[model samples]
Target: MKNVKLISLALSMLICFVVSAQERTITGTISDKSGQALPGVNVQIQKTKKSATTDFDGKYNIQAQKGDVILITFIGYQNQTKTIGDENIINVVLQEDNQSLQEVVVTTAMASKKRKATKSSTQMVQGKVAGVAISSGYVQYAPSQSIVVRDVVSLSPKNEPLYILDGVPVKSDQFAKINPNDIQDVKVLKDKDATSTYGSKASNGVVVIDTKNGIYKNLTEKELDAKLNIVHPAPTPNQEDYDAFVENAFESPKTAPLSTFSIDVDNASYTNIRRFINNGQAVPKDAVRVEEMVNFFKYNYPQPKDQHPFSINTELSDSPWNTKNQILRIGLQGKNIATENLPASNMVFLIDVSGSMEDDNKLPLLIQSMKILVNELRAKDNVAIVVYAGAAGLVLPPTSGDEKETINDALESLQAGGSTAGGAGIELAYKIAAENFIKDGNNRVILATDGDFNVGSSSNSDMEKLIEQKRKTGVFLTCLGYGMGNYKDSKMETLADKGNGNYAYIDNIQEANRFLGKEFKGSMFAIAKDVKIQIEFNPKQVQAYRLIGYENRKLRPEDFKNDAIDAGELGSNHTVTALYEIIPAGVESDYLNQQPDALKYTKVQETANNYNDELATIKFRYKKPDGDKSIEMVNVIPNKTVALNKASDDFKFSTAVAWFGLKLRDSKLISNKSTTDILKLAKQGLSRDSEGYKAEFIRLVESAKNVL
Candidate 1:
């Protein structure tokens, strides 16, 4: 009887063990906000303590009896407990928890608040942001100064920013064509940290433009919906050219022989004259430095009536990096079209000739560029030149717009030198402009340089304060960038934003024509200000995601209000684009697995409608610069990720370009990147290429590959 009982008990024990061994298995991954793996977390069965610690992947395995509780714990994190119900597998992510009293970093315009720091270095800090390259082709127009934020089309090999200009997703680069005089300011965001809100495309960067409007009169629907046409006259003879022609025409051969500055001729009172402008001295009564006067004067053109085409007219000269012995000329149908003999116009040609401006594409391009504007001068405009080297100095004085010879001599006389004293140069330029304050005419300083204000007065706050002070004088600023290496793009954009001006990057002649000639008001005249863009993602319509660019342009949840925060402007035909990469739910792969410990800690909640596939909705708020009211524009983008093969040429090209930038910066996020990919994308996207944009992309790709 005892033997029989033992046999039955052993059989019973074996049956129970067999039942316990039939448990189910589940799998997944664990990560932090930046997608890095989490490790060493504790994952366990809640009531029974039957548990497992997360392996290197924060993954775990456990056996629960029917219904069981699972609890997870980690340092500096809240403990999470979950019940194992009908679900076979569970995944999680533990969120960081910080007390309200804990010290943190808060970014303010003026200063940085660091609660803990061993030491600090003298690094330059500013509020300007960076842009993700859209395409090697558009790179020809990369850092395009016009910072309008609207382009919804996928990246083409030649597409610019994808901000919706006016209404559609036009290339925000259109803003680059407007005259700075028409704009009130511009702001840019360049890093993922600042622009994540706009998603993948913004991952490249984001630009905000501020335009100027008239008094508070609200327009009708027709007025609001009216198509805007931004047209600027050709860069014929602006004030600079006018002065040169005038000086040349009025040789005064009969007068006493003039003193040449450095000719085996003379270096006479030029330095003294330089010192005078530095000291804010009035123009000497008998001294005629035509270039100075042309740059320092202002012109008030009759605003075109609403019925006529809104036109823009201005000239910007991009000079050679080294001004010694260089000759380049651009001519057109006429000179500054001044009906009343070239009115007493005030002009500021803000030149950015920094060390970064050393390349042929930069300083050299600038020198040649200035010739275009010099060709478009009228006798009435007055000009001045304030240059920043290691420090600021007056390269030229306020001379008559009619003194063409004098102006040309002054322009041809400059040479590349030490560090960029952009800040000092700006300070002097504004002072000169303010001192010669024009009542109602146009007073603008046109800055030409690669956007790098590194050495002195390089703080964001300092620049902001200085610009505000200058703007109070009702004087405007415009930025013209030259070169590629070490381009301080974010910096140039920020100054333009604060100075109520426009920003542009000139890579070649066509760009100059498009900007200095084609779109003046959109670039210079501000039609709006404090433009705000908000993208709301419907959680029900999307899954896991990331914003690719515009890292630095991210706004705090609260910045959309209070009326004090600044934004970007819009130019006619401007297109801005924002792209997002989505990770679809239920599409499980190795990339989706999380460790058991992390899963226990993370309590992810997904609603039933999470597969809407709609990426995000865009909302825009803007105020007419000179007015008191606000306006808006909005759009929606569905969440769709096509095979890389089917993507738009613009999209593919942009992706390739972004890959190149990542390679340049050695970023780990982008992988398997090469010139081959760029070439491939360009080949795939080159449909109906315009102005050789697609061809250029191919050329650049070949060049990069060849050099490699």
Candidate 2:
């Protein structure tokens, strides 16, 4: 009986040991093959209810017993097992599954010579693979729809499918340069199972093309011959160019009593400058057009209430930079017509498909931008496409806007190659516009480019003359500048100015939506043409003054009366703002030139007793869309002074923008002001910012503070 009790006690101890071991805790970390943490991995103890999921850091703890089987599994990777031993901590490294890999589609064996029969390598991809989609058009990136494999997983602007040629990865454009005849086989890999091996870049999809000769081996005679006879043209590089405009200096109001300039509604400078600042580059001095920056954001100016297409508003306040000087704000608010009420549009998309436009920002962005504009077209609207690259050609004839798919298909058919022939492209675009002319309607040519014109009639003078002549056809122009590096702001401004059009720079899709989708009517239709502003400052109240910006837009005092002379065009609901820095008659300083030595040659007219009470007389002249004659309006502003803090939000916001421009140019005229000050002023003016553009401007100011 004693021996039986001892054996029973020993068995009880063994049972206790097993029970204790079964309830122990196991802890470890989980990661992928690259040693990166893998969150959400399942860590379970087999045959038990105890399991834990990896935290964000890939660390996990689970209840397990010694010798218990533990399972760790994650999507896109192979399941792993571990038998818990004496060790309390057991790390795991999961391997991706090979057999269950993302299903890759490959073309059933076709003879290389058979593939060679196609005009382009992209053609070889069509109808061969089950899941792969191949489209053809003059698209921004691919000549087709980026060779998508099923649905793409990228949220980037450049979601180009990756190509691996004969064990070497190549750019899509480079693949286009390779001879189609030299390719032996093609395979497309989709999803993470097949693309994980390529890391993050293969998320969009992958195309593996086996060439006749691998990089490891010398080309066979057949392959060499095929390459030498290939018809693919090599991509050429582009050079950058921009026009230089000297900054306007402060003018002596006593000698030059009048400031005359065409009112500019273009906002290209603001967006382009934003691009430069976001890229951590110093803004080019010439790129800082203050007028464009000021006009980029809309103000609270009242809409026109009478026969005039727009209303004129003026404000005077102490300058933010130099408290001693005063600022005069001139604003023009154009009439806002509902989209349904706007005239029918006749649009010709003058697109540049030159090799220089191969960059994602240049051609691909252009395609997406145009797509937005295309979606906004009405059923009666007409659309045409003219592309220039080496030479100009009509890709799509005039088509009804109601046929959106057909227009989109034509847009997708575009491809970038060869040299830029912008001039010939413009001529062709103008011809097509004239062929489909719509009288008393919105007849306009929307030219989109990086402004790299190389072939015939490429000079600014030539382009100006060509567009100037084309402007007589009653077909207005809208210059949409795209890309960077080689952007020709001067040329685009010149074209828009000479062609009676507006200019806008599109940096990304958000901007594209802003210009083409949200503000479609205003961007495409014009309310007034040949819009000019002439302000005659009274020497009695003002000693000296300078027109901010408009250096390239200045007109002779006599040009304002010449209806034949061309000026800027005002679009529907467009707002133009001009700021002037003036020195009061009593405020003495070095900038005044001492009243120009009392005007030795001519006798000065005696001022009327009430002239000092009138600060300035503002005159505006513009022609109706169909009228050749001009109508004039005049307004007299009394001498007024207001504190910077008491000025209207419109005045304050414009002052902030002007101050930011002066800071960017490092101007010696305006006193030094910090970006923080500008941000503060901008925030106060952020009322009624429903579109969020003003909010975006605030962010830009913050970004500029970091870089500047």
Candidate 3:
């Protein structure tokens, strides 16, 4: 009996040892050999029932007994098993299940892309992706019936898919401004099944935007084939005080300065004055307005093409309203780094004394963070301040220009919570600058608030029109934006653009310093205004080309010469990048049209003889607001066909952004583009992010994979 008990106990002890020895965690990635994510890939302890399917990202968090046998199985990819590994992150690549690995109808960020899709989602959705819409600022007051998926971001609260630009959850809760040109592509992941990766965060769905990496930031330009235009002129304009009209007139700068407006004697056929007087059209051709038509062109400044390695093409033309108002703009470009004159001097302060500006992003940081810029101000500069909340007034007006003290005091007293009339505060500031306007000064009006113009004349349209009128007074504008929860980025951008100003977000202290101190040139000072570029195809030189992202900025060919047509301004060191995807005609695919005239229809045939020349010829025009004459430039791209697949990293990176943008909008125009192709190309094209943007891209891609 004693011997039997000992043997039984020994067996029990052995069983315990065996169970203890099975304690181990096996981890690995589950993907198909072709590099496709395999969701529902079951991972478990071989003998136990413990298992978990891969999350949308093909990622699983699981634990098993040591040295335990693990099983991984997916519906299509071949099953995989590995012993317990010590590594923290385990990635698995699964092989196709042959009979099971059918085609996939992967919905990538709301856009459907085929992935060997055995499912019916092939050929993408018939018309437009689901749940997308276009919110055009040009037509905000106009009710739109269009569905989702527009290239431009909508300011309205609803239907804006969550943005994970470069992985930073997109700080655009309110008035988050993103440069369409800066974005790579926006993947709209709208479906619950597709966006479930983020749980509640993705409940609103997600859009993954990959932005332009400072391409080739690490390498010197190899070919340097890009041609750019360099601009130079007088002192920079004051964008903030864009409205200080000598509210009193003093004549000194120009002798016998003519009134800004004149009757169109050349265009008007009537030489008799009395006949025209009845129409209110001949009021007083002598009403001389400011030369800077509206807020857009009141000032002229120099651009740095010499300090940088970029080239420029300049264009000159007569203003459509009055040939006396010559129009000039320069295109400064480069393959990389865009060696151009960048901004370096700037001082902006936010006086957050308002009830509406109290939110975290809106006014608190807006007030506390002037230290970022205050600390970086140079001895060559001066700072000014004007504050208004309950009343239109100035707390500090252009101090002997102690920038440090001026910025600090302005930041110290700023607070939110009361009716604010932004218009009144801004007006008081210019009154002070008129006395302090620097002869060649970079005079500016830096308004920091929630943009609530409630106190007096605060309507967005009213503010824009007023600021537009103010710019003629010759003080430019710069807006330092803060506060969220009802931030009006659309309104602010309008005010800034019309004021010949630049706008930036103070998401954090780092961004504050970057804009106010570090990147001073690119943020302040205008090098050119109303820049317009027109490419006239030698119908013989090329068959078809696409303007990638500036869909909203497209100008009527005739407007290219009309000085009145407003265009985006370029700051020193600022780069305006654009891309065109082209397809040469006669390559077998019919790019032209052949619709016969049926019932009221028309048919036209134009031969591809125009495709005979090289690539395309580019035309550009600009005017020095002060100089009576306009300056112009042009460049012709040779028809030499560079391999599309072998485009430069810059070209490739830009190309990827465009492809994704099209996908986000569900544009069927760009043929044969796929989610996988974008990923494949971007894998090798990613550039380092000194600004943390690159890291955000990787995370966005990983998030995008779950949806696709």
Candidate 4:
């Protein structure tokens, strides 16, 4: 009996030891004393190889046994240590290290070293440090002798720092071709320091090289290639896809007198075009949607004095590109509802976590964008998260918006992998949204993706059908596009258009702030849906008219009155603008190339109407957020025309934007207007620039000039 008891006791103790030795995930957030989250901070299990780095939100998770000591370290911050216990969460606030702040800290994959920020100090310690190798000579694939850094474990296949020659990103092979003698300065950033700035492209590291006089500055990729004689492989091609569209042609009042189309609130094309220009690349002609470019900026319009959801304004001026032609501007401003008065929201974040979204710009930037949106959420709002990879799944159930930490934790835990099953994810998200439907409230599914849907039901038509069917459930969609290469813009645009939603491309955090932060109500709450615009050009006053941009949004004249036909949705506080180039009656131009012959069989009757001074009759049809029937409004544009130089700032700015788009598209209709002309016109309209968006437009125009 004694011997049996001893064996039983020993086994019980062994079992207890095994339970204590098991590892569990330790997750926590690290912030500075001022409560700012510190990203790229290193957290490691002391005496063990297990470690993790805090993400953009300063959240980290690592596996370790209870009682293991974990050390947290970040440059310019005092190191911290904590012992793991029963609690799985351990939040830390680090204090600044004054001494460390004064010195330059060089971090490598293996460890970090600090030294005085003396001139050429980093160069002197380059090769002396372990895991860092610097060599000067003709390296592999390089034509000239250049300083190359090696020895660190590469996160990329090539395992070298991403080289930024001047301000443009270049491949290592191209970096090597530059003459070392012309080099001005070289700066290297490693680990989080590098990735934080450049995203996933700099996961291995980044080396920014500035040449004397910036010989390669502001050069487009094609220009750089030509200058350097860089031969690229023929098999590689840019995978980004955009729907091809033809520019709208001039229509004769004698034949097609009615100009009809849906109003588009989407601004994706403008930002996407801006991305190309900012990156020093030739803007793709097909990617330029003049309507989106004009509508991207908010215009000054009077508020509605009546019960209408939006107010309409009209202006007439001479066309900037062609002084002989006239420009007509129609503007609609949605009523701005205060955040407190806006209806409660039931939002499902339908995120794509596929392998294609693993890029730093796609996923990481997306997460940061969501965090900004979360900050805008009110206590009454609720959020759910559904992610799609190889398949669709809900990572977080419907949680109150007040529980921001929980929602953010869910966002932070997401990892990009597997093939895209966007269709399945959309179904699941709509189902969740329907189940948690807020009647008369804002119930929506916000999809953030690179739009690279490759799995089941991945085609553009497939997505359009899926979204069209799902939208009947009263659950709207908001498509937020991300990333560059392989980006499927057509798919995103189709989903948004079919689902009664708006689409915006988020290229950086600032854009996210603009769409989801500062303009939260306008981006999230719909005041009107199925908004259509139709104009009856006065045959007595106008001979020919052309609708600028919005080529794909054109609707049949009968479709405007058809309540069943779908159109664009106008969000609260949103503005929509449209321009028309008009040819006055009896005025002949090259655009009105071939006039239709007079009718042979029928006698045309001309009725004398009292509105001889009218340029056009504008009709607007829209449905309330929850209404089935459409409401119609009509406004008349008078025959008065203002000089382009005397037009309102908004009119001048919008015309300038339209002119820029025409220039970029190389539209034959536009008379030969140089970039200098566009710049001058843009500066004239650069008033009421509170957000600096107009100023940014001016800068983009300058950039376009330099690159084009």
Tell how far residue 427 is off in model 4, in angstroms: 0.9
State the lDDT of candidate 2 residue by residue for 1-708, as single tens digits.
Answer: 999999999999999998985777788889978898776687878887566667545777777778899988775468999998899899999874434211224332232122332235435555543334433311123433555544423423454666775555555655555554455455566555334445334545567665544441234434533665544466355344556776677776556878899988889999998998877667887788889999988888799999999999999998888778999999999999888898888899999999978776887678878878888888999999999999999999999888988997787667678999988999999999999998899999999999878899888999999999999999999999998877888789889989989999998767786788767777788899999999988888887889988887899999999999999888888888999999888886655553445656775677547486789999999999877999999999889888888999888888888889878877778774778888998887778764557777788888887667
lDDT of every predicted structure (CA atoms): 0.46, 0.78, 0.46, 0.84
Query: Which lDDT value does model 3 have at 201?
Result: 33
- Listed in order, each prediction's TM-score against the native is 0.43, 0.70, 0.49, 0.74
**Of the candidates shown, which would achieve the greatest lDDT relative to the real structure?**
4
For model 4, give the RMSD to the true fold: 14.0
Error of 1 at 605 (Å): 11
lDDT of 1 by residue, 491-586 (tens): 665576676665666655444544554334344434445555555555443333333333333455466554555554443222233333333434
For candidate 1, the lDDT comes to: 0.46
Q: Compose the digit string of candidate 3's lDDT tens values, residues 1-708.
A: 999999999999999998877655444456766676555467877877566556444656566654555677753246777666556456878764334223323254435554432113322322344443223211011133322433344422344445554434533321134443443333445555433443333434455544456221122222111211212256354112111111112111112111111100010011111112222232222111111111111111234445332355433322121212222222354213232322223233436467766554565466545655555445655566666678765555444434565556555555455677677777776666555665544556677765556668766678878888766655667776664444555556567666756655465444454465555554555555555667654434334444443433456666666766555555554554444434344433333344234333332245655445545566666543222233445667555543435544444443454444444334545454566776665555565333333333334443444333
Residue 505's C-alpha lDDT in candidate 2?
A: 95
Q: What is the overall TM-score of model 2 with all chains considered together? A: 0.70
Higher-ranked by lDDT: 2 or 4: 4
